[model samples]
Target chain A: MTAAVEIAGITKRFGEVVAVDNIDLQIDDGEFFAMLGPSGCGKTTTLRMIAGLEFPTEGSLKIFGNEVGTLPPNKRPVNTVFQNYALFPHMSVRDNVSFGLRMQGTTKSEANRRAGELIELVQLTGLESRKPGQLSGGQQQRVALARALVNKPKVLLLDEPLGALDLKLRQEMQNELKSLQRELGVSFVFVTHDQEEALTMSDRIAVMDKGKLLQVGTAEELYERPLNRFVADFIGQTNLLDATVADDDMIVLGNGTKIKAPNPHSPGTKVAMSLRPEAIEIGRRGDVPADHVATSLNGVVSAMNYLGHSLVYQVKIDWIDLEVRTDPVASEDRLGPGDDVSIWWDRTADWVVPDE
Target chain B: MSGVITPRGASRTLLSINSLLVFLFFYAPIILLIIFSFSDNRNVGVWGGFTLDWYGEFADSQPTRKALWNSIQIAVASTIVSVVLGTLGALALERFTFRGKQVFDALLYLPIIIPDVTMAVMMLLFFAELAGVLGLSKGFATITLSHIAFSISFVSVVVRARIAGMDERLEEAAMDLYASRWQAFRYVTLPLIMPGILGGGLLALTLSLDDVVITQFVAGPGWTTLPVFVFGLIRKGVTPLINAVSVVMLLASMALVALSLFVQRVRTTDSA
Candidate 1:
């Protein structure tokens, strides 16, 4: 299928400040793509440019092969659900959902009928006449989704649509939004600051920071093989161990531990190795099987936290804290702070990320 | 509740006393005037038997009636002009940034900050100079224009406050839903700020109706507003007739104020 949205060499400058640096991306049709970044990372700006709410100072933006950079928002073939669910406060739920159709010159009866179907799809069937103010936050969010989807635009842009909801409601809405996009089979560009949300819902995720696109790939690809230090630290918790390249496939850590990585630079080239906490195995000395252990380090447990299903232990070794997460098991002796333990992990789990 | 009640009782009692004093200071003179308006005596401050004679006399006064008509005409014209101009001015100031914006903002508040006497003098001199150059004379038109000039600032202040309180995302949402800029403003921004526009209009109407000094400086032959006429009557003497007229004007002003407050309340409730 042809690309649903194509951005080429887009750079949005406000006076002397660059809000979005040179960015070129292609979003496939029917793909659930996410732009993940912290605040002021230009994720929302890029989304706005795609929706035609903003025009790039330097580039071409196309939707389904049609150049739409200079088009106004009203002329774009896309709809946005704003961060605050910006539903028209003066209009009823039905009117708000029907607004796009009415603006497109659809007759009132047809618009209302279409809106009614979307309302039911969002599970807000009886709230057709209620004003936005009378509804709860979650209901309002669903109303916003229905309103944007009711237009049946080629692309749907959502800017942190679940940021306002509580944790439980956010999870529920996240699933609903994912299923809705699946059912519609339309391109969805979801902008969020949440790594978990992006990982859970996106077919592909783009990590951005400070007006620059850092990395873009599938969730597993980006998480397991973050190309730079920012992405490796941003996606999840990881303890970075500074190391110098020892050979073509090995590096020496500051603590003198030798590890193997996929791509090795020249000898003495500084690198950072990223190790996930869950990948590390922790046990008393002589407990771990020799066949499963590739490398081992001894350290004292500095801190231990019980998380019901799992126990997180921070092991202090040679002035570096290595985190180990494991499922809780029945034992008379539990690992507590100040307990000596051995931590080991598979050599394949050591991933090399760019320094700085 | 009991734990929280120890130190607040004295403050609450003091607040009530302060409110009582404020009410007395504000309403005592107006209450006295209303009471005397119904007295049969010719002079005020001496109560005679209750009678509606002064009100009857006020109704029969032809000069007072003509002055009332002139005030209404000026108020209506000036209110409409000021509301339209002020709403546009507020939209420009609050929604857009342009060159000399700070200077324009400072100038917008000039009419509001200048004293009434100074403003009246300045307007009179400016109008007189223009009238001389154009071979014109000051009259109803000059008075209406001056009223509008001063009233525009008041209207813009109110409307700008309303705009500031409004959510800009509503208009953006409208535009995203395929509304043109004009359509978005007409359907969303205009309705949201209508209460402020009405409040400003009522304020302008009341200001024009109550203007005495500006009208005095600008009025030509046979062009006296109610306030100017009432000032003249006060200079001649204080009478029950004056009291009756003042009471009626006060009631009308009060009604307009009440309506303005009611509009603001409705707008707040709608938004909430």
Candidate 2:
């Protein structure tokens, strides 16, 4: 089947500054896709190009095999939930939701009937006559969602839709949005700076930085094996150690400890190794089994942070410091600062990434 | 002593007295004018008894009626032309950036910045040149044109302020919902900025009605607005008829201003 959105060599330039550089992507039908990046990373710009709100300076954008690169936003078979909701303040909730239908020449009664169903879908039945100004922020967000979804476009473009909500409300909306996308079975192109939100909601995420698509993969693929240093640092908390390839299945850490891991690069080539804090097991020396240890090092605990479920210990070994997360309930001994501990991980725990 | 604050009650009393004095100073002449307008006496400020004779005379006077009609015509005509042009100008300045935008912006403010006498003189010369070349004599057209010229600035200034506070994303939202560019403007932007347009139109009407200096300079023979006619009447002599006319003009302008304020209040509440 053809992709819902096929962006080929898309690049958007505002005068001299390239907001979205040449990047190619394919979002599958009914797929929950997210473009994840920091602010000014061109994620929003890429989404706008898909929605036809901003035309790419150089690109061939196709929606279901139809060329829509220079098409106006109104002509595109897509809808956008803007960052700020952008509901018409003068319009009632019903009118706002029914606007797209009305614009398409649907009769008022027909539009309202369809809008009523959507309002109920978003759980805003009684607020049909109330203006956007009268609704709370979360309610306004729902109205924005309903407004965009009422059109039933092939792809729904959401630009940081939950960025305005409070943390608890945001989490609630995040679950709602994920389920809503599932229920509708429409492609969703969500743009967000929050990595956790992207990881939790998106089926496949395109991580972007400096107007470039750095990597595109599943949550597990990205977190487990990031291609470069930037992807490893961005996805989640991980210790990226500067190392050099020593053998086919080994790498040397800065402290000269040989770690047993897959090294894609040639020998003597400098590389970076990503080790998740949870992957590293910390205990007293000689407590861990010798067979389970791929590499082990003795370190002194410099600091500890209690995170309710787990304790993150900053372990200092020679000149290198590694963060080791341990489940407080599983471990009998409570480690503190200045305690001598051994940190070890399985061979599969560490992945080698290019230093760039 | 320097750090000590004034007592609340004492400061309140002082502020009340100052407010009373200021109000009295401003309204005393207007109140006297209104009261004397109802007087039966022929001489100014002398009350023989309460009577509606001056108002009757004002209604009966053909020249005064003609002047009033002329003022209304000029005000309405100028208001319509100015509001349209000014709204377009404001949208251009606020929504787009083009070559020489800064110069155009500065020029839009010139009419509002210059003194009335200076503007009047400049308009007089402009109309004189137009009359010489285009055979367009200064009359109703000149007065209306000059009013539109000055009123455009005021209307645009008010409209630009409204546009500035508005969110541009609303227009984008409209377009994203399948509205064409013109449709988005009509259904979304126009309705949103309507209060400003109404306010600006009222302001232009009020300014056109109240104008005397510019009207006098541009008006040809037998083409006098009420204010200009009133100014001419004042030169001949102040009469009870003048007071009645002044009261009527004052009340009409006040009503327009009140309506403008009402429109603004509705906008604030609607947006809030």
Candidate 3:
């Protein structure tokens, strides 16, 4: 199937500053694609260019295999739910939703009937009479979603639509938005600064940094196989260890430990290895496996935090602090800040790459 | 203010005092004019007596009625011309990023900064130059044009502030909904700018209604506006009739203020 939206080598620049570097992405039809990054990472700008709110300084955009770069936003079959929900504060929810249809020259009755269906879809049935200010943040978000969806856009662009909601409401809206996207069977190009939001809703996540596409993959894939240090550090938590490349697939650690990986590094080249905290296990010396499948490192438990079901131990290795998560129920011996401990992990779990 | 209390209590007190001072400053002259308007005394002093005779006389006065009619025409014409130009000028000043903006800002604010006498004289000089070139004379048209030129600058100044704070994303959202530039302006920008449009119109109307210095310079043998007529009346010494007329002007000013406040309150609430 053709992608609903295809951004090819898009580059945006403000004189000397490159806001979005040469980047290419293809979003499948009816798929939830998230462009996740920190602020100023060009996620919102990318979405804007796609929505025709902005024109890319270079390259082209295609909707269903047709170039839409020069097209005005109104001509494009896409809608956007802007941050703060940008609902027409002067108009009630129904009118706000009907505005797009009205602009498209829909008859009054037709527009209102379509808006009524959308209102119910967003679970804001009775709120059609309330102005944007009279509704709660969640309700306003629903109104914005309903308003955008009322036009039956081929793709809906959301620029951090849930950023204004409280934590609990934001989480609820996240699931609600995902389900709504699925129900509508329209591709959604969501821009968000929150990784968890991207991970929760996206079929494929594009992690961006400094206007560059760091990596694009499923949540688990991006987290498990981040291409570089930026992606690894950004997608989730990882402690980078200094290592010397042993071969195309192996690297020797600082404390004389060795690990294997699929990454290509020249022998004796300086490389960085990422080890996830949960992958590392805490145990007594005799419990260690006498095989090359795992690498063990000795450290002292500097601090132990009891996190309901699990305990997080801040373990001090030779020269670095390593976080280790262990089951609190099984760990009968409570370790204090200064307690010595051994940390072990499968050698395959260590992700080795060029130092960057 | 104690450490226990923030500026909240003190600010509220300050706001109340400011409101009281403003109310007194605005209404005290109107109150005096009203009291003197109804007085039957030929010489209004300490309210010698109350009667409707002055009102009857003022109403029957031909020159007074004509002056009133002339003021209305000039004010209405100037307001229409000024507001249209003022709104466009304000939007241009606020929206587009351009060269000479600092210069434009200073130019827009120049009419307000200069003394009324200076503004009146400059306008007279410009009009004299125009008449010399085009073989014309200062008249009702000249007076109306002068009012529009000076008061439009005031209207633009009042509106530009509101326009500056307006959310530009509303226009973007409008376009995203498939609205063309014209549609975006008509639907999104126009409604958002209604308050500022009204503000500019009111400013222009009020300024034109009360203009004295500019009108005195611009009006020729053919023109006689209310302020000019009032000046001629005052030269003959203040009368119960002048006070009577003044009372009517005072009431009209009050009504204009009430209308403006009503627009402002409604616009502010709508925006909120």
Candidate 4:
């Protein structure tokens, strides 16, 4: 697969503040790639550099294998859907969509004709004469989308495009945007602070922190196998256990339970064993054991929560607290506070990292 | 302007009274000056049964006519120059950040606060030496310079306020739509800022036209602006012709302000 955008060693600075450090990246043709990070982490800046709105201070950006280092934003073959919709306040919906065509010196008739077609595509067919202020926020977003998409550029950049919408509208827009990308088949570089949004929309996600790209991978890879504690914590919830590697495949935790993990480690090395809440099981058993690959500990259910789709139980064993998903609809064996049970898990469920 | 109110009776009467007082305070003298303009009598108090005598006097005299024409010329020239430079300056100030920005803005606004008399004296001295070296006289050149210098601050302030109120993200949005900076300015920034530029230009035009103190110091033998001409007329005695000119000035100002208010309302309704 040929890459459409190759961002090689891109670095941008605002005086002493380094907004984007030297970054090397490539985006495939017609793929939806998301740059995910917290605010001020340089994800938006990186998107700007890629769009040519910002020139990287110390590196190169290539579009379709052409070195576009000194190209102005208008010269770049990318369009952006801004976060706040930024629909031209003075222009009618149709004129707003036709703006890019007009700039390219297309005939007025042709521009209007094309804009009308694009407007329909975005499902804003009748609201043509209305100015941006007349429309609701969601409607404004659609108009913004139509305006940018009308140009049919090589790539489209959306900077948290759904950020201004209510939660329900945002979820609806996320699905629409995903489907739109699929239908258009244009390379898309999206920037968002929302990890869940990135997970839902991205073909690949690049997680950045403090001007550095921490890890870039598929959502599944990043979710199931994060590169570090930061990526692990950022992507999803993980219960980090303080433990020591007793030997290869075995970790003797501080609470006197020895658990087995698949990864090999040196003996006596301190580690943080990451256990996904779904990994642990809550059940009552007369016999309980602790071993390398499979382990069990006797505990009492400290709390029980019905989580719509699943039941969650907080179990206190000896001294340590463990969270487990229990049977949600078990009438006879409903776990509650002070109910004794054994919490167990398969070794495959946890990822162990050297904490110290 | 409304006379009726729903359970509010004396409040509206008070409002009308306040409005009338404000109008009377500002415009009564201008109306008097206009009435006096038609008086044929040398004494402005007694309107000698309505005559076009002062208008005739004002128009027939070559020097007075030339001075008025010269003022118009200066206002047009100064307005065009100040507007272009001031608009661009406002754009640059809004778009970029550099060192001494606060100082720069303060310096721009300084002329408005400084005493005009001091500026005239200082500029006169500066121009006198420069003119001597250049072997040229200060009249059109000096007055034009003063008007432009003073008008730039007004123009810049208005344009800056207009630009600052604009949503900055709109430019980024334009860029996202593959628009060049120039295109964005042409389609977006220029249209939005046109009102401020026009408004500022009108203010500068009015200022340049009516100025007396600065024009007195700067006028050469060949160049006598309308204000200077009017001042000379006043020195002779308070003629009704001066009143005539004053009324015309007042009318022009009213027209300009009305246009601005109308434009502002339309813009609000059209956009919002």
Instruction: Write model 2 residue lDDT over B112-203, tens digit each, in one string.
Output: 99999999999999988778787778788999999999999999999999999899999999999999999999999998899889989998
Please rank every candidate by lDDT, starting with the best.
Answer: 2, 1, 3, 4
**Highest-scoring model, lDDT:** 2
The alpha-carbon interface RMSD of model 1 comes to 1.8
- Write one digit per residue (lDDT tens) for candidate 4, span A98-130: 998888888999999999999999898999999
Tens digit of lDDT per residue, candidate 3, span A24-67?
A: 99999999999999999989889999999888999989999989
Which stretches in model 2 have alpha-carbon errors above 4 Å?
A255-258, A267-269, A285-294, A305-308, A329-335, B1-8, B262-272
lDDT of each: 0.90, 0.92, 0.85, 0.84
Give the candidate order by descending DockQ: 2, 4, 3, 1
Q: What TM-score, over all chains together, does every model reach?
A: 0.91, 0.95, 0.91, 0.91
lDDT of 3 at A7: 89
Candidate 3 - chain A - TM: 0.94
lDDT of 1 by residue, A61-144 (tens): 999999999899999989999998999887889999999999889999999999999999999999898889999999999999
DockQ of each: 0.52, 0.65, 0.59, 0.62
- Lowest summed lDDT across 10 adjacent residues in model 2 chain B is found at B263-272
- Indicate whether candidate 2 or candidate 4 has the larger lDDT: 2
lDDT of 1 by residue, B141-223 (tens): 99999999999999999999999999888888888999999989988899888888998899899999999888899898889
Model 3 misplaced stretches (Cα beyond 4 Å):
A252-262, A268-270, A285-287, A328-340, B1-29, B39-53, B134-136, B262-272
**Model 2 chain A worst lDDT window (10 residues):** A327-336
> Residue A355, candidate 2: how far off, in angstroms?
2.0
Q: What is the C-alpha RMSD of each candidate to the true structure, in Å?
A: 3.2, 3.0, 3.7, 3.2
Task: Give the top-scoring candidate (DockQ).
Answer: 2
